[model samples]
Target: MAKNQRRSVTVTLLYVFFIINQALTDGPRFVEPIPNVTVPLGRDANLPCVVENLGTYKVAWIHIDRQMILTIHRHVISRIPRFSVSHDNAKTWLLHVNNVHKEDRGYYMCQVNTNPMISQVGYLQVVVPPNIIDSLSTPSSVAVRENQNVSLTCKAEGFPTPKIMWRRGDSQEITVRKRKVAVYEGEHLNLTRISRTEMGVYLCIATNGVPPSVSKRVVVDVEFPPMIWVPNQLVGAPAGTDVSLDCHTEAHPKAISYWVRDNVMLLPTKKYGADLTENSYMAHMKLTVRNLQATDFGNYRCISKNSLGETEGSIRLYEIPMPTTISRPTEVRSQLHKENLAKRNVSKISQEERVKSKMMSSYDSDEINSHREIENRHESGNGYHTPSSPQLSGCISITRWTFPQFAAVILNCFFYHCRV
Candidate 1:
């Protein structure tokens, strides 16, 4: 009886030892540690849940935030196409997310279905690259006058709020807050008292330690008052000839140009012409004078006006005299002789002198004899002269004979001179 009882105790001890050894060797336990995962946007992510001695107890993955079940063992229970499941030898259970987005970042729970569910949680951190928002940002190109203030803004969105940096696109130094800096860090860029050198393209970069940084190109246009330049300030042209005047101008906000003569606006007419052409920020003005006259010679101003200011460039128009030819001396002598003859014919006779001369006395016989002698000499030289009487005749007879004969002879001589 004692032998039998010892045998039963040994058997019981062996059975208890066998049971303890089985319990130590066979049970589901996590073999690999679940670690926190970090992934960039638009990339694939993997969450590994590994087990050892995992028998029929299936492994399941659940999203903690929404309490949504993602997978059970190797089968995906989630309706989303991006969520998938895979395992190797019932040991490694992987939850795969293809093309992960910002919303995919959260805590994922890996649970084992035992008598009471056992679970381990790991956090998924999704990092996103920078993206620039166009609507909220300022204009891509802006125009501001010199010596004025201007502000630029950059807006961006990302997983982590992106930081904005301002830099010159041409690699030049930038002015910020009245100080010159190579690279400025801020969402708002303020420039005070802008200058001509500050006109260029600016780059606004947005970054948050993510791959593929984004940038925007912004152009800065610095405007100023209209400035005029004329190559020839003094212009000369001959009368009855065409003349053209030109003036070049540079300005922003575009300037309107016209020609002004002596402060009077010159319009396009049959004798005057005006033309204007524009290229970028420059304007070319031309005023053409056809059939130029003496009155057209004066100071001409090219006036340019804009929203900023107005300016003028002046040009002088001078008249060139017409050349004349010299005449012969014979022509001048003939002209003088014709003028003397006209003057002699238009002279009036004096009535007092005629009456006194007609009543001659006998005491003047010597003078009368001298006159008769001169008359005889003239008659001997040419047949055109007539001889006079030596003695004085009656007043009525002398007046009648001399007056009629003298008047007829004078009329014949005047006609003969004009025909010659």
Candidate 2:
């Protein structure tokens, strides 16, 4: 009798302990953060919810959007890769799903164990195929000086993979494309020994079974053979206030730009300059010369070309004048323009420059003062001059631009100045 009484007492004590533990801080329960979620086709996704005062209340995951119910997880839930439960800060819960199928697209619910409380809803959206890119861009469009390394790429992103093709405008003197025996990524069309004939519009086509195929045009430009330009530049720049250079082209078969110093491509970072407008052929290409150094001096050009022609313009970037006082930053940019404007007139470049003259006119300044101002302020330490003039607005209208798109630019000929 005594032994039985002691056993009964021990059982009662254990039961009391269990009740106390359950009644602790598991006060109220709630879920938060997401009310909706978006997912792409053939990709993994995660849905999260939380439970507060999680003592007495347990968390459960459920499908709230589906016509038929789907339970993802429970306190004593199943453990599978397609679905897994997790906790954060020992409070909230989450469900992750891999290889999301089409039918798996719907709303989910997160509920906690409580009285008349504890429920949250989340929606999932599955993105279909045939997405179009708004527009295209490239690194830089330079008139290659005389002779230098010409590296360029065509970058595009869409639902379907894009196919790139190169062609010329005026003449078809392009380097004979070696019939390929193998497939290569971007590297197949190498212009290591590029000339004027290797310039044109490199078209990028994105296609899927859906309606019309989407495409992006990239213009390539080669110039000057590859030489030099002269200007003062700050070698090093601060984190937030870094002055940079920009290159744009209105040519087909886009141009490739790089940041070369001591015969090397310089990576743009906190201090060093960078090759801006990357992987774009037909549009604008820009490079930011960072952490300016005296050695970064010499000829810097916007080299660009296509199968029909090649062109380059030199802009020499020298070292910045060290700070003599604390001023509000400064930059000096300068441009050299003349009435002659080279209509293929230079004896050495008569045949070539003439064909390129119309091409160069797009880059030439009708308001020579404005371009000169851009160049003058560029070299001095007076700080960067962001063009905020109403004349040069970036408001993009839906209507298509024929020559601007074909030329790789839309020179803002605001009626104010009216330069033909």
Candidate 3:
């Protein structure tokens, strides 16, 4: 019973010692400083504050910018629904900002209700994506006349101040300030003396190193009168052949293209066919004439008309004479050989005639003398003449014959007379 009494007294002494120590060090003091937080807009943010020895002392959060208390202990003081506070039950306090907005970005204070009223400050950063302001920006579409100056404007709003750039939607180059560039780094794009070639969609891009970069499209329309270019102004084709005449036209608001012949509109038919191909602002006009006749050779007009003006191009269709091919010597040689074969089988020729016949058979078909002799034979009677006759026989001229040919003729005559 005495030992049990001693043990109880010792436990009472240790409890008293612990209570005295708690009374000496029982005050809320920050153990870890608050850390700055950065979060995107519409996201939650948590600012932590750690303290030690907090014994019944109230912990509070304050908005340094507004100089207002956000929370006290576990009760929220701010009426804003998005502001709240929590703790780890052991000295760590958290300030919660739900669905943070731009106004929430500022310095936040983690405070403690002590004799000295200790506090620490942390910053809250809220970032926002780029957004284009259409009210202050250029319109969706802009119309201008040819050779006129034009300007495009862009406006945007975002955190960190968005940077604006200009570019062409078609990925083509832009002429600005007497220079050409793929991208123009400015809020305004200025064009001087704008032509049809410079008309297209212009894009205004805004970014701030954040997600969801945005852009706006502005269309630039340039109006112009109708103009035409004739690829084949003077087309030549032979009779009974096919020919095509072409004309290229450029205009705005689309253009009507057609072909006119002798003040009459030419329609699609078996002999005359008209066709048109169109691009954005350019058109190709073609007229086809099948089985060209003598009457088809004339001037044809390609006409293009638009809301601005009308233009026409003239093309002259002329006849190109077809090439004439002369018959080859082989055909003439074949005819001569056929006639010589008939003469040899039908009647017997004299020795002189035989010599002449052999020479004629071996003659080069290219020589005109052979053809002339054969023609003379057909004109004369029996192609022969007697000694008393004044006319020469239908044979190769003796003056034109070679020495070998003359000797052969002489020998043949001599032998023939000897035999007689």
Judged by TM-score, which candidate is best?
3
Off by over 4 Å in 1: 1-25, 115-117, 143-146, 221-223, 229-248, 257-300, 316-420
Clashing pairs in 3: none
Please say which candidate is ahead in lDDT: 1 or 2. 1
RMSD of each: 24.5, 39.9, 13.9
Write down the lDDT of every candidate, Cα atoms only.
0.83, 0.52, 0.85
lDDT of 3 by residue, 1-420 (tens): 999999999999999999999877777678878888989899999999999888878889999898889999899999999999888888798999999999999999988888889889999999999999999999999988899999999999999899999999889999997899999988888999998988889999999988889999999989898999998788999999999999999998788889999999999999888888887778888899999999999999999888889999999999999978988999989999999998886666565578666755444332345446646865886554322311243223454445555555455445434221
lDDT of 2 at 234: 28
- How far residue 417's Cα lies from its native spot in candidate 3, in Å, is 39
- Which of the two, 2 or 3, has more lDDT? 3
lDDT, candidate 2, at 358: 60
Candidate 2 stretches greater than 4 Å from native: 1-26, 67-81, 131-420
